[model samples]
Every structure is written in C-alpha cells, then in structure tokens.
Target: MHAFVHEGNELIYKNLNDPVIEKGKVIIALRAAGLNHRDLNIPSRRGENSIPLVLGSDGAGVIEQVGEGVKELTIGDEVIINPGLGWEKNSDAPPKGFEILGMPDNGTFAEKIVIDAKQVEKKPDHLNWDEAGVLALPALTGYRTLFTKAQVKKGDTIFIPGAGSGVATYLIQFAKAAGAKVIVTSRSKEKLGKAKEIGADLAIDTHEDWESLLRNETIDIVIDSVGRATFNRSLSVLKKGGKMITFGSTTDDEITINIRQFFYGQYQLFGSTMGSTEEFKEMLDFISKHQIKPVVDHVFPLNNTQAAFDYLRAGKQFGKVAISINR
Candidate 1:
C-alpha cells in the first residue's frame, strides 16, 4: 500500500506493508482522509522522532475485511473511523490509555488501514467521500465541546473565537442548529463572510478590539480553541457565570487570569478533547437529522499530499483539507 510517511521534517510517499488484521480489527480500503492542525505540529517533532509516526486521525472508508467477533460490520460496508481509540463511553474524562488514530498506528493516509471494528461507524449516505472523510474528528471535537462540555442551550448567545478551523466551523453550525445565536471571530474578512454565509449571527474581525465592536455585550457561552492570543478576551466577553468550553490551544497554551474576577463572577470552565463513541453516534444522528454537511475547503489526491499539508500549514484553508485516497 502507498502511504505518506513523516520522516525527517518531510512527508514521503512510499510503499509500506499492508496492515495485518488483529483479533478485533477490520481492514478498511480507505477512500478518503482528512488533515487537522495536529498534523501540522507532528512535522515539527521530526528531529526528535516524536511525530505521531504516520500522521493522520480522520478518515472514511469501505470495509474490505473483518476480523473475529466483528459481527456488527461486514465487508463492503462504508464507514468513518472514529479516531478516538480506547475510550468507549462518556465519563468525566476519557479513561486512562486513551489514544487517537493516525499515530503509533498507521492512519488513513494510505490506501488501506486496519482499525478496531468497534470504532467504525456507518457513513452517512448524504455525505460524499470527501465530506465523510473529514467529518469525524472535528465534528466530534466540536460536538463534545459545545453540547457536552459547554451545555449550549436554545436562544443562548454563544461566542466562538477563531472561525476558520474545521472544529470552529462545525461549532457554528451546531450552535445555530440548536437555536443559539452564534457569533464568531476571525482576522480574515473573507472567512468572516463565509461564517455568516453558514449561519453565524455575528462575525467580528479580531484585528480590531472585539470588545469595542461587541459593545462589551455579555455572551452566554464561549467556545474557544485559540489559547493565549484570545483566551482573556474570550473570557471577558462571556456573561458572568457563563460556560466556557476550550479544546485546543493553537497559540501559546500558558495563560493567566484574574482570580478575583473568576471567583466573584462565577465562570464555568470545561476542557474537552476527542469524544466518546456514544457521543460520536449521537453526533452522527444529529448531523444526519439536520442534514448538515461539513465545509470542505479543498481536496487533494493522496499522492499530492504535500501540497495539501502545505496549504493547511499556511492557514490558507478556511475549512477542512481532505486527501482523496482512492478517487
């Protein structure tokens, strides 16, 4: 099988051995795969050999072979890899030993991959290969961050900082679908317009003082992924006692906050990551029920993966960048 291998600060397409099926695993003939910001960080660890090794965590494919005890799925079934491995159910947090796909284990960058049968869910018929391939990781992250962690409610004024990411884009869609007034921030005016096109109630340019633009309006909920660059301002916009959900820190993770304001104002803070299998199922149902489709900014053929990686690393894409594995 052909795979994009991350070695020495570069991605190389090479012929790698096919994944051997395990007792509870199934071989998937990958049709499509997707990129995340995490992939961008992996290349930086090249000299240290700390890269996820294969570098990918999102994919949609067709089952080509099934292993023992995998009675729920069969060959020829179209499915999406959940990526979040070893965490089966919802809890206060993911249990110890949890891992995501695409590192240590070969991920979807190849034409084939072997994954736990339990982690594969039926792909929605409404989404095409590219859409399905990019759906799982970001959508799950967004869903758990907004609905489970933040507990967003109808008619709530929800503010999401950083509007162009796959997760941030999905947050806007989910919040609006749940009847919340969705506001988003981005430095790119074009991205801000795209956010409004997709249902954001208000879009603000972060290049200016967002507090002034918003008139210091208290937001009911704040879903943030950008860390040090916007964390303080994100908190400042939230209504006192409002919920704030954070999943990623693309900028500096180290942070400082006014302890007195936090205690006296009574803010609810929650940190989230990849979600449970149960939540993945619920996310699928919600998206299908609402007929929501993810925003795919670009799709590149598997062999042209370098260009895709470069595009994502440059932060030029407004939505998910997908790799077309088979077609």
Candidate 2:
C-alpha cells in the first residue's frame, strides 16, 4: 500500500503495509478526502522520519472490512467518516488534555486506513462522495457554535466576519435556515457578491468604514473566525448583552480587548471547536432535510493534496477543498 507520510518538514509518497483492522474497527477504501489547515500544522513525531504521517482529516468511502463487535456496519457500506469522534466522550466528561485525530494517530489521506467503527456513519444519500468527504468537520464545528454555544434563533441577526472560509460558509447557510438574518463581511467585493449569491442578506467590506456604514447598529450574535484582524470590530458590532462565538484564529490570535466591553456591555463571548457525533448527525439530517450543501471550492486527487494545502494556506478559497480518493 502507498501512503503520504510527513518527513520532518515535508510529505513524501511512499509504500507502507496495509493497516490491520482491529476489533471494533473498520477498514475503509477511501473514495475521497478533504484537507483542512490542521493537516499542515501537525509537527512530525520523528524529526527526520521517512514515513510521514498521513495528512487528511475528513473523508468518505466504502467499507472494505469491519472488525469484531461492529454490528452496525458491514463491508460495502458507503459511509462518511467523522474525524471528531471522541466529542461524545469528551462532552460527557472530558479528559484533562484531549487531542484531535490526524495529529498523534494516522489520518484519512491514504488509499486505505482503519478506524474504530464509532468514527464513521452511513453517508447521506443526498451527498456525493466528495460532498460527504468534506461535510463532517466543518459542519460539526459550525453546528456547535450556532446551536450549542451561541443558541442562535429565528429573527436573530448574526454577523459573520469573513464569508469565504468553510466555517463561515456553513454559518451563512445554517443561520439562514434557522430563520436568522445573516450579515457577512469580506474584504473583496467579488467575494461579498458571492456571499450574497449564497444567501447572505447583507455583505460588507471589512476594509471599508464598516463601523460608519453600520453606525448605531448592533447584532444579536457575531461569529468570528478571523480573530485578531476582526475581533475589535466584532466586539463593537454586538448589541448590549448579545453574544459572540469565536472559533479558529485564522488571523493572528492575539488582540487587545476593552475590558469595559465585557462588564458594562454585558456581552457573552464563547469559544468553540468541533462538536459531538450527535451534533454531526443532526447537521447531516439538517442538510438532507433543508437541502443545504457545502460550497466546495475545488476537488483534487489524493495524490495532489499538496496543491490543496497550498490553496488553503494561500487563503484564496471561497469554500472547502476536497481530495477525491476513490476515482
């Protein structure tokens, strides 16, 4: 079997033995995989090891084999693999320090890989392999923030800073489905136009005098992934006692805060990561029922993953980047 391994600072395509299926695990014939920024940041365990770690986080494929005690799934079943499988255990009673998949363990970038049966779920018929491959991580992250952390509701006005990334893209669609008015911001007029095409009610240029453009205005919720670059703006736009959800720090993480904004303003700020499997399932069903689809920027072969990584690193994407692993 051939897999992409991370060697120190680079990834190499090399031959490796097929991973044996363990009890309660399943072997998936990966049809496709999706790349996220995390895949590029994991430090190699061995400084100069030749066998680079697998570099994919999300994928979907057919089941080739199932391990003992795995009754819910069988060989030949098509499934979407959820990378954040431990969220159930973590949410019930989290450990002192919990780590996500694709970091210490092997990941989904290979032709074949084995994982616990709990890590996968049947792929929704509404989604193609490429769509299923990219759905799990970003949808789960968005679901947790919108429903669990921020508790977004109908008639709520949610402001999202940056409308092109995966999380923000999902937030825009999901917020609209929930009957909330979504206001999006992007630096590019063309990107903001795309945001409107995708259902954003109002799209503003972050570089413009947005504060003045929205003078004396406030929103019920603000979801910001561009941390340092837009944190102050997010704080300034929220109505008194409103909430803001912070997820990835795509922009620089550090920012100066006015402590008075927290006290006198009575605002709530919540940080979120990936959500539980229940939330993942809920999102899948929501997409199926609502016909909400993720905006896929492009699809590449598994062999060309570096290009996808480069695209994401360059930050020019308006949606998720998927790697087709099946054919």
Candidate 3:
C-alpha cells in the first residue's frame, strides 16, 4: 500500500505494507481524502511523531473487510469516518480520551486504512466521493458551532471571520440554510464577492472600516476562527448578551479581553473543537436534507499532497482542498 507519510517533518509519499485489521476495527479502501489546516502543522512535529506517520484527518471510502464483533457493518459499505475517536455525543467539551485522527493514529492519506468499527458512518446519498471525504471535519465543526454552541435560530444574525477557509465556507452556507443572516469578512474583495455569491447576506472587506459598516446592527452570534486578530473586534459587533464561539487560533493564540465590557454586557464566551459522532450524523442529515454541496476549491491526486498542503498554508483556497486517492 502507498501513503503520504510524515518523515523528518516533511510529508512525502511512501509505499508500505498494507495495514492489518485489528479486532473491532475495519479496513477502508480510500476513494478520496481532504486536507485541513491541522495538516499544515505536520512539519512542526519533528520529534513528536515517529517515522513514517500517515497524516490525514478527513476521508470517505468503501469497507473492504470488517474485524471481530462488528455485526452491523459488512464488506462493500460506503462510508465517511467520524475522525473523532472518543467523544460520541454533544457536550460542553470533548471527553477525557478525545482524539482526532491523523496525529496519534494513522489517517486516511493512504490507499487503504483501518479503524474502529464505531468510527464509520454510511456516506450520505446526496454527496459524491470527494464531497463525502471532506464533509466530516469542517462540516462537523461548523454544525457544532452554529447549532450546538451558538444555538443559532431563524432570523438570527451570524457573523463569521476569515471567510475563505474551509470551515468559514461551510459556516456561511450552513448559517444561511438555517435562515440566519450571514455576514463574512475577508481581506480579498474577490473572496468576499465569492462568499456573497454563496449565500452570505453581507461581505465586508477586512481592510476597510467593517465595524463602522456594522455600527447599526447587533449580531446575535459571532464565530471567530481567526483568534487574536478578530477576537476583540468580534466582541464589539455582538449585541448585549450575545454569544461568541472560538474554534481555531489560526492567528496568534493569546488574546486580551475587556473584562468590564464582557461582564457588564452579560456576553457569553465559549470554546469548541471538532465535534462528536452524534453531531457528525446530525450535520450529515441536515446537509442531505438541504441538498447542500460542500465547496471544493481544488482536487489533487494523492501524489500531489505536498502541493495541496502548500495551497492550504498560503491561504489561497476558497473551500476544502481534496485528494483523490483512487485516482
């Protein structure tokens, strides 16, 4: 079997023996895999990861075989992995043993992979292979942020910062489908326009006076994935008692919050991570019901994963960057 392996902090293609299916695990013949910002951190794992680590978190494929005690699944099942290992339901935070795929475990950047039977879910009928492969991570993150954490409702005003990334793209569409008024910010005018074309009610240029433009409106919820760069300004855009959910810190992780304003306004601040299996299913069902197709910026072959990671790191992609493993 061939896989993209992390060696000396560099992601390179390698051919290794096929992984054996352990008891209570299943083997998947990957059709497609998707890239995330986490994949960019691979180079930093110099001493942490052992030799030849397979690095990928999201994917969809078909089951080639099932391990012991797996009564529900069978060979030839088309599915997308939950990726999240421990957490199975919605909660205030991930469970004690929570782990995402690709870091500690071998991931989907391979021709074949193995996982616990509990990690797989039947692929949504409405989505194709590439779409299903990318849907689990960003969609789960967006769904948990909007529906579980923020509790977004119809007619609510939702604001998302850094509009061009994979999670932001999914957030824009998900909030819109739920009948929320979506506002996105991007430094690129063209990216802002693309966001608007995809159902964002308002797109603000981050280079300009975006706060001034939103001076009259009170945001119901603000989802900030940009971290330090937007956290302070995001608070200013929210209404009194509004909610703000922070996921990734793509920018600087450390931030200063105005203690007086935060307490006086009764604002709610929360943190979220990749969602549980239950939330993943709910997200999948909602997407299937709404007929929402996740935006794919480009599809690279498995051998071109380095270029895919480069594209993601350069912040050029408007949506998910996927790899066609079977191709």
- Of 2 and 3, the candidate ranking higher by lDDT: 3
Candidate 1 lDDT, 1-327, residue by residue in tens: 888878765678878778888888899999999999887776664455534256689999999989988989989999999999889988879999998887666778889998888889999999999999999999999999888888888989998889999998899999989999989999999999999999998999887777777765659999888999999999887888999888999899999999999989899999999899999999999999999999999999999888998899899688899999977
Q: State, as a TM-score between 0 and 1, how close model 3 is to the true structure.
A: 0.97
For 1-327, candidate 2 gives per-residue lDDT tens digits of 666668766777667789898999999999888788777676434467554687677888999999999999989999988888456542623344545567667888889989989888899898888888888888888988998898889999999999998888889999999999998998888889989988899999888776677775569999999889899888887888999889889879898898975789999988888877777788888888889888888997877777877888888888799888758
Question: Model 1 — which ten-residue stretch has the worst lDDT?
Answer: 45-54
Question: Distance (Å) between predicted and true CA of 157, model 2?
Answer: 0.5
Q: Give per-residue CA lDDT, model 3, range 11-89, as digits (tens).
A: 7898989989889999999999999988778658545445788989999999998999998789999999998999987
RMSD of each: 1.7, 1.9, 1.3
Error of 1 at 69 (Å): 1.8
Ranking by TM-score: 3, 1, 2
**Candidate 3: global Cα-lDDT?**
0.89
- Displacement of the residue 78 alpha carbon in candidate 2, Å: 0.9
Ranked by lDDT, the better of candidates 1 and 3 is 3
**Which is better, 2 or 3, measured by TM-score?**
3
Q: Each prediction's Cα lDDT score?
A: 0.89, 0.83, 0.89
